[model samples]
Target: MLKLFRSAASIAALILGIAGVFLVLYAWRLPPFTGTVQTTDNAYVRGQVTIISPQLAGYLAEVAVQDFQHVKAGQVLVKIDDRIFEQKLQQAKATLASQQAALANSEQKRRSDEARIASSKAQVDSAKAALTAAEANWKRIEPLLERGVTTQSQADQARASLDQATAALHQADAAEEVARQDLTSTLVNRQSLEAAVQSAEAAVHLAEIDLQNTRIVAPQDGRLGEVGARVGQYVAAGTQLMALVPEKVWVIANFKETQLAGMKVGQPVTFTVDALQHAELTGHIERFSPAAGSEFSVLRADNATGNFTKVAQRVPVRIAIDPNQPLAERLAPGMSVIVSADTSTAASDVPATGTAPGATPPAQVSEQ
Candidate 1:
């Protein structure tokens, strides 16, 4: 009986030890114990950080907001010296007015030329009538002179009168041509004046744009990072004035390639922020990186050159945070977080079939 009891005790202890090992493996999701939940600590909040710069160079006249101050769209953040821009606008307007006046003057000159042309035409008509009368008189006088009915002097005078009438007609035609030419020149000058007016108007518009740019305003509703400008400090064009961080932010999780087999867009995700006391937040997988993280490295490895040892590559997954969450609002770019995606849900669009393109052959997946 003592030998039988010893054997039974040994069997019972062995069974208990095996059960404990299985339990530990199940808790850690190892091998056969793995499920559809994929998790990674390689996650961070991200946002569009925009750098504010000046479009024109000038001295800082005013700093309206302080560092980290929340601002609305179009709210003035800083003011540059605008006196020069204002003067330029005024000068442009004056130039525009001068060109317009010149254009008007050109119109008046055209009208005067038209009137002169009409006067010239009337003189031409008069000359034609006079020449007709003079030719008739000369013809009558020459016949009378040959018959001895008129004096030689009178015949000579009639011929001379005919010549004078012909000269006067030629002068009238020349005057009319000159008047038409003057009108043509005036019309051409008017076109040049019109172009000048357009150019001046454009200059005025540009000056107005520069003047408006003097007041640096927030491009969107966001918070300022810092105030780098001070009164009387000169800044050049494209100089960085500050940084703006919009309220919209999301999380990026770099999960191993092997873990992406069941992952898909729209999978429910939960994350805990280290900055917010590990407060849990809910989100959904928005999208996946087109290529593995290794593809984006500055110095990519050439596995073909070296002895190959297969290692799993990480693929970035973008998760969209659910709105109206109190803790989600506190999340900022660069904040670390642990993200978990529940892949058991109805599968949506998966990013990769097996190994993602540009990624190494996936290694055996184990919860990292």
Candidate 2:
């Protein structure tokens, strides 16, 4: 009986050992493994942060927002002193009015010139008729004097009358020429007046735009950061006054290059936030970085010219937080997170955000 019990115990021990090995293999995605998951501690919550600035320089007359206040889009945030800008706008309006008046007068003058030209043409016609009569009279007087039918004094008087008529006709022609020139000149001057009016209108528009800039407003719905602006403080254009963090936030997990062999977009991800007492959160893989994180560093590694050692690189993977989850709604940026991805085949997949474009964008560098 003791020998039979020992044989049974040996068989049971062998079976237990085989089961343990199978469980280990399953966790690592080896052959005969039923489950597969990849996890990484190198992850954190991130989101878009908008920096607020001014478009015009002025003394701040009012700071309407308090520090860390939640503001809606188009809400009043800051106010600049608009006394000068208002005056400029009024001045522009007055200038525009004056130009309009000048333009009207020019057009009226042009009309008057046209009428005068017509009168001058009538005078020219009368002068031509008078000139023809004077020439005929002078010819008749000369023939009569030559035939002795008229006296020398009579002929002299007739010649003098003809000369007077000729001078009168010349004067009329000169007056008509002067009128034509005046009409042409008036037409040309009207164009200059039109140009002046357009210029004044542009000035008025610019003044109005500047006045509107005095009242600064929020660009989107977000929570305000530290409000450094104060009433009576003089601020310059493009001065940073505050920051805005939007409500939407997500995470980026940096996984080892070797671990990305079978990872893909739309894979379900599980994460825990360190700030929230390690509260578990779920998401899906949105996209992957085009290159390793080190490639974007300010001082890139140059293995071609120096002693080098190959090291496993980390590639950032974007994860879109499931908006329906309560925890996702409460999550904020800058929180540390531990993320894991299910890399199993033939498993239910999570819906995915679209993949990123193939080309990488240039990194932005700022001094402060």
**Most accurate candidate by lDDT:** 1
Error of 2 at 30 (Å): 10
- Candidates' C-alpha lDDT: 0.88, 0.84
lDDT score for candidate 1 against the true structure: 0.88
Please identify model 2 stretches exceeding 4 Å from their true place: 1-36, 136-146, 151-174, 345-353, 356-368
The digit string of per-residue lDDT tens for model 1 on 1-368 reads: 99999999999999999999999999777778898898899999999999999999999999999999999999999999999999999999999899989888888998999999999999999999999999999989998999999999999999999999999999999999999999899988888999999998999899999999999999999888977888899999999989999999999999998888877666789999998889999998776788899999999999988589999899898888989898777888999999999888774354322333344533542211
Q: Candidate 1: worst 10 consecutive residues by lDDT?
A: 359-368
The TM-scores of all predictions, comma-separated, are 0.83, 0.77
What is the Å distance of residue 334 in model 1 from its true position? 1.7
Residue range 88-114, candidate 2, lDDT tens digits: 999999999999999899888888888
Model 1 stretches with alpha carbons more than 4 Å out: 1-30, 347-368
Backbone collision count in every prediction? 0, 0
What value does the lDDT take at residue 70 in candidate 1? Answer: 94
